[model samples]
Target: MIIKVENLTKVFKSYQRGNTFGEAVKSLFVRKPIYVHALKGISFNIEEGELVGFLGPNGAGKSTTLKILTGIMHPSGGKAEIMGYTPWKDRKKYVAKIGAVFGQKSQLLWDIPPVDAFYLNKAIYSIPERSFKKTLHKMVELLGVEELIKKPTRQLSLGERMKCEFIMAMLHKPKIVFLDEPTIGLDVIAKDKIREFILEMNRNGVTFILTTHDLDDIAHLAQRVIVVNHGEIVFDDSLTTLRNYLGVKKIISVSTMRPLPELRLPGIKITNRISDYKAELELDLSKYELNKFIALVNKSSTIMDLSVQDPEIEEVIKGLYH
Candidate 1:
């Protein structure tokens, strides 16, 4: 196993004012704070080279778990080990072998060119000149950011800056990568590029634990997903298993060769009727397989266009929480 998390928990103390004036005055003398359980006994294992999705809704402790795993923060209780090292206790040594790109935070020097930050990383990671150059070249190429490298970080667009961030994170050739909402603000084209780069890295045996709200990213990248909700692991399984667990709903959109009257199938619910010849239906996939469902649709009218949409991963996670 590359990662072992056993009943991990983290508590944060929060203070509030006393309701009554007397109580508030007393609290001014001797204050008491409340404790928030950010992580409520989360436990899971990740094998080497496995790409997993760390999923949860906002305030669901997803970031807390990642911080603990990446050595950015300590857990209040239980155990977490990465690559045989306790993350928080041995952070200096542990972090050297792991790379992280926090979407909410930028690691680049804002006023300097990205290349300068690359050298800073080389010094920080103690990379040999030859190795640093080699890795830097490869990362820039893989991320398609060779031109962006020479540009000042502050001047670059959000998508360009993100690409540079990825290159810098990977410059040291870390064995594991923790990406938090990597594509959060990227447009569709930029998001696709980042997704491609991540898949390429995973193919080269760099394990990934990605946290993102982008269901498309999860659908296209991670084969396994671990969903956390209310500070607990609500689900953990392969993507296919998750789809089945949620009873994956399929959207069938049809464009008829000619106008057709209103219709309904037993397992299909009409979501929208775009035109006389076009209609969209949401089908619960558990009840009807794709081929069978399509065959049934074709029986009613001559089909011109049709597409089967799988349930988005966001919808699956949402189902778990709400």
Candidate 2:
């Protein structure tokens, strides 16, 4: 395994004051801080060259786990080893072998062009000139950001800056990269571009650990997903397995050639009716097979078109929380 964690945990201390002034004053001098267990003995491992999605709702300790793995924070308990190095204990050497990108943070100098930051990263990492040039060229080409590299960071669009961020993180060619919400605020086109670049990099043998609220990213990039809730590993399995486990229900949208007099079927509920000719129905797959349902529909109505869709990834994840 390229990454290993066992019984990893982190606790945070926070203080809360009373509503009354007198109570607040008294509590300030003699109050116990609240302890929040951000991570609760979560354990998992990732092999080399694998792309995995680390998913959870807000405050579920996803960021804490990423920070610990990237050497930014220490776990209060448990052990984690990446590329044979303990992250917090060996921060300096460990960082050199890995890369990280947090969406809300900026590693590039605000006033400087990305090209300048790239050069600075080269010096900081002590990357040989030949390797730096080759990597930079490939990154720029793959990202289609050759023209944006020379623009000041502030002048660039969110998508442009994000592409530069990826380049900076990958210039040294680290074995593992941690990306937290890499496409948080980009439009659909920009999101697709970023996903494409990530797929390309993974194909070329770079390991990626991605955390995002966007399920599209997971569907497109991850072969495996590890879902956490309330600081615990609630689900850890391949994407296909996840779908199968949660795929007892399905949505089918049908469009008929003409309006029908009446429509009824067992184990199917019409969720929406767009006129008499078009309707969306929810199917209970456990009670009815898909083929049989389709046959019934075709026999009853003149079908113009139909599409069967699995439940949305968000709903499947939301189910984990309950």
Candidate 3:
């Protein structure tokens, strides 16, 4: 395994004070402490060269786990081993074998050109000149950001800046990479380009752990997914398994010559009613027969058109969140 985490846990201490002025003033002298359990003994293993998606709603311990694994913050309990090294204990040596890119955080100085920041990373990592230049050129070329590197950071667009951010994190070509929302806000074209770049790099044997709210990213890049909620890992399986998490559920859109009947039936939910004659429903095959429902709908409304599709992936994820 490239990464193994056993019973990982984190707790944060914070002060709580009442809203009243008296309580606020009293809180300063006699503070009430609240312990927040951000992680509750989550465990998982990741093999080398596997692209996994680490996902969760906000405040669901996703960030906390990432911090511990990256060695920036110490966990309250449990153990994690990445490539046979304890992240928090092996500090300097561990970091050299891994890279991270936080979408909200910038590694490059705002006023300086990205190339200058690249040089700074080169010095910090002590990479050989020839290898540094070769890697930089390859990434820049793959991302089509050759000329953008010379422009000031502030001058680059969000997409442009993100491309440079990837280069900054990969200068040393670490074995593993941690990406947090790498495509937060971007046009469709830019998102596609970024996805392609990540796939190409993964093809070269770079393991990626991506945490993003974008389901598109998860669907396109991840072979495996790990979902956390309420400070615990609720689901960890292949993307296919996640899609089938709720069992056999399908979406059905129907248009008929007459108004539809009240879908007051088991295993069927009216998801959308565009009009009296046009409606969309979700059918759970496990509870109700598809042929029977079709016959009923056809008899009542004289079906003009009907289409069936798999439920959106979001439906599966939302089910897990609840």
lDDT of each: 0.88, 0.91, 0.94
Candidate 1 Cα misplacement greater than 4 A, ranges: 17-32, 257-265, 285-304
lDDT top scorer: 3
Candidate 2 lDDT by residue in tens digits, 1-322: 9999999999999887788999889897988689999999999999999999999999999999999999989899999989999999999999998988878898888888999999999999999999999999999999999999998899999989999999999999988999999999999999999999989989889999999999999999999999999999999999877776765889899987767445466678888898888999889898788998877777778788999998888878888877
TM-score of each: 0.89, 0.94, 0.94
Give the poorly placed runs of model 2, Cα more than 4 Å off.
19-28, 257-266
Model 1 C-alpha lDDT per residue in residues 125-237, reported as the tens digit of each score: 99999999988888888778888889889899999999998998998889999999999889999998999999999999999999988888898899899998889999999
Ranking under lDDT, best-scoring first?
3, 2, 1
lDDT of 1 at 69: 92
lDDT of 1: 0.88
